[model samples]
Target: MKVLEAYDLVKVYRRRKVVDMVDLKVTEGKIVGLLGPNGAGKTT
Candidate 1:
């Protein structure tokens, strides 16, 4: 089973695509981490 799922996730700012065509899935009992540079839109 999937605890969390995201499909085609996208974020844009000022004509720039921060996140484009991204997919993510977190399965049951699984741990996940997202790491990125300071301005790499990790929080977006």
Candidate 2:
């Protein structure tokens, strides 16, 4: 089962894009983590 799904995710700040064209999927009972340094767009 899919717990979360996303497609074509885009995030922009000012004229620059923080995140672009990201596809993500999380199924049931799955563990997911975003690892990145500060300002690496991990939250974007």
Tens-digit per-residue lDDT, 1-43, candidate 2: 9989999989886676877898999999999998867876776
Flag clash pairs in model 2.
Answer: none
TM-score of 2: 0.74
Compare the candidates by lDDT and give the number of the best one. Answer: 1
Q: What is the lDDT of residue 28 in candidate 2?
A: 95
lDDT of 1 by residue, 1-44 (tens): 99899999999966778888989999999988988778877776
- Cα lDDT, all candidates: 0.86, 0.84
Candidate 1, which segments miss by more than 4 Å at Cα?
Answer: none
**Which residue pairs does candidate 1 place in steric collision?**
none
Residue 43 displacement in candidate 2 (angstroms)? 3.2
The stretch of ten residues in a row with the least summed lDDT in candidate 1 is: 35-44
RMSD to the hidden true structure, all candidates: 1.4, 1.6
Residue 10 CA displacement from its true place in model 2, Å: 0.5
